[model samples]
Target: MLKKILFALIMSVFFIGIVSGCSESSDKEEGKGSGKQTVKIGYFPNLTHSATIIALEKGFFEEEFGKDVTIETKTVANGGLFMEAMATKAIDVGTTGPGPLLNFYVKNKEYHLISGAVNGGAVLVSAGSSKISDLKDLDGKKVAIPVIGSTQDVMLRKALKDVGLKPTTNGGSVELFASAPADTAALFVQKQVDAAATQEPWGYVLENQAKGKLLLNWDEFAWGKDSPNTVVAASQNFLDKKGFSASYLKAHKKAVDFIQNNPEESQELVIKHLKELTGKELSKEEVAAAFSRLEVTTNVNEEVIQEMADISKEAGYIPSADIKGLIDLSTLEEVSK
Candidate 1:
C-alpha cells in the first residue's frame, strides 16, 4: 500500500508538470496578442519627425497593437546612433531616411522598410554670402550637414554633382562639415560655414530668426519635389520570427491616416509632444508651415526609394545599394488591407 501511494504521487507530479508546460506555451501565444512584447522605438525629437509625435499623441500604435502595448521613445543625437541601436536590436523600430538605411544594408545589416514617415524636409542655406546661391559658388566653401550618410547629405552631394562638383577632393568645389541642424544654423549665423543643408524647422529657424539666406529649397534641388524623408524600419530577424510586422505596419498606417485627417489637431499634438520631448515649442505658424511642407505617407514604392539610393551613390555615400530588396512592402500591403 505504501509503494502504491508513492507511485501515485509520482504520476500526479508528472501530470502536473506536463500541464504546466502546456499552459506556459499557451500563455506566450496569448501574450503576443495581449501586447506582452515591448515595442521600443527611436527617433530624433524634431519638427521633421512630426509624424512620430502625431502617431504617439493619437494612440495609433496602441490601437493597432491593442491596449497593453508599450511604446518607449529614445531620442538619439543623430540618425547614425539611431540606426546603430536598430542594428544591435537595442531598438525594435526606428524612423530615418534612405541614405543611412542603404548604408546599413550595404554593410549586410538586416532590416526591412515597413513604411514611409515624411518627405520634403531638406534644404541648403547660406550664411550671409550671396555668392553661395548656386552650386558653382560652393567651390572651396565650407558647408555643414547633419551627418555624412544622412538623407540630407545624400541629396546635397547629388545636388552638388549636378552642378559639376565633388566633395573632399580638390577642384571638387564644396567642403561639407558635420553639424546638427540647429547647431549648423548657429554656424551659419556666426558665418562659420558658407552654407549648410538641413531639414526644417531648422531651415525655417535660420531663415526667419537668424537672417540667414535660403540657398536651395529641397524642392528646387536635384530630385525636384520632396523625396521620402523618414522611413519606419524593423529588424529582419524580428519580422521573420515573431511575425509582428503586420501589426506594426497597421499602427504606422494608422499614424499616416491620423495626420492626414486631422491636420490642425495633429499639429497641436506634435507641438505638445515636441515640447514634452525637447522642452521647447515653435509658433503655430511655424508648425503649420513645417506640416504643409512635409509629406507624411507610408508608400514604400520602389521607384522613389531607388531615386534616393541613386542620390546616395552620387554623393559617394555608397558605391551602390539594392533598394528594391530593402523594402518589405508586403508587410504594409497586408496591414493596409
Candidate 2:
C-alpha cells in the first residue's frame, strides 16, 4: 500500500510558510558570512516539467532562495541524463521523472525525492498511417522512448506486459529504441519508429506535426492518472543543507499553484520558455493540449512510486527494488503542524 497525500491549495500555503521560514532561520544562523551558496538545478525541457519552467520564468525560486543564494541551472534532455548529472554532483536538485529517480536511487542511494512535480504526461502514440489502433496492435512494431529506464519506458513495459507482449529486450516483437524525446518526432515522421511512449508536448507535436496518433492518452495509459511522472529530487548534499530542501519545496508549491490557478498564462509562459531553452517553438494549441494532459501537484502516491521501482528492477535496470527512505516529506509534514 502506498501513502497518499493530496494537498489542498490553502494547505500548501500554510506548508510553504512554515517550511521556508525554517530555511531562512537556519541560513541566518549560519551567519559565518560564507558569502553566497550556489544551488545547481536541473530539469527537462518538457511540459511535464512546466512547474519548474514556470518557477524559473516567474522568479519563484529566486524569490524563495533570496539574495544569499546563487542559482544555476542545466537543461537535461531526459531523466536518465538528469540522474546522471545528479550522480556527478553536477545537479544539486531539480525535477525528473519517478522512473529514472528510482532506477538511479536503487544503486546510488544518493537522491531524496523532495516533492512531486507532475503526474500523467506520458502517452502511447503510433503512426497515423499505421494499422495499429491500440496497445494490442503494437506487435512487431518499433517503439521509441526517451531512454531504456525512463518513466515512459517503464509505463510502456507495464502496458506491454498487460497485453502479453514485450519489447525485444525480453525477446518480444517490439524493438525499443532510445532517443531524446525532442528527437523522437523525427523518427515518427520518417516512419523510423512505429510508436513512441513519450511525454509532452512532443507527444502533442508528433500528433499535430508528424501525423502520429494517440493510442493511449495521459489519463488512459498504464497507470493512467495515478502515475507519478515528474518529481523534485535533491542530491545528498542538497538535503544536508539544513532547511534548503524545505525552501526549495516552498518555491515548488508556488509553481504548482501558479500553474493550476493560471493555466492560460502558464501555457504562454511555457511556450516562451521552451522556445528560449530549445529553440524549438511549439504552437499554442499543442502547448495547450500538452499542458492539459498532466496534473501539477506536490502530493505523491508512494505506492505508485514503489511499483515503478519494482518495474525498473524487473526490467533489469536497477539492482534492487528496496528504495527505503527514498522520499522525505517530513519537512512538509512538520510545517503543517
Most lDDT-accurate candidate: 2
Per-residue lDDT tens digits for candidate 2, residues 1-337, read: 1233444666788999998888877776554345678888999887888988999999988988888888899998888899889999889999998888888788877798988889998899898867689798899988998888888999999899889998888778888998888788788778898899989888888888889899999998888888888999999888899878877888888889999999999999998998998798888888888878999988888988888888788788888899998998887665434
How far out, in Å, is residue 230 in model 1?
A: 0.7
Alpha-carbon shift of residue 324 in model 1 (angstroms) = 4.7
Question: Which stretches of candidate 2 lie above 4 Å from their native place?
Answer: 1-34, 335-337
lDDT: worst 10-residue window of model 1: 29-38
lDDT of 1: 0.75
Top TM-score model: 2
> In model 2, how large is the Cα lDDT of residue 328?
88
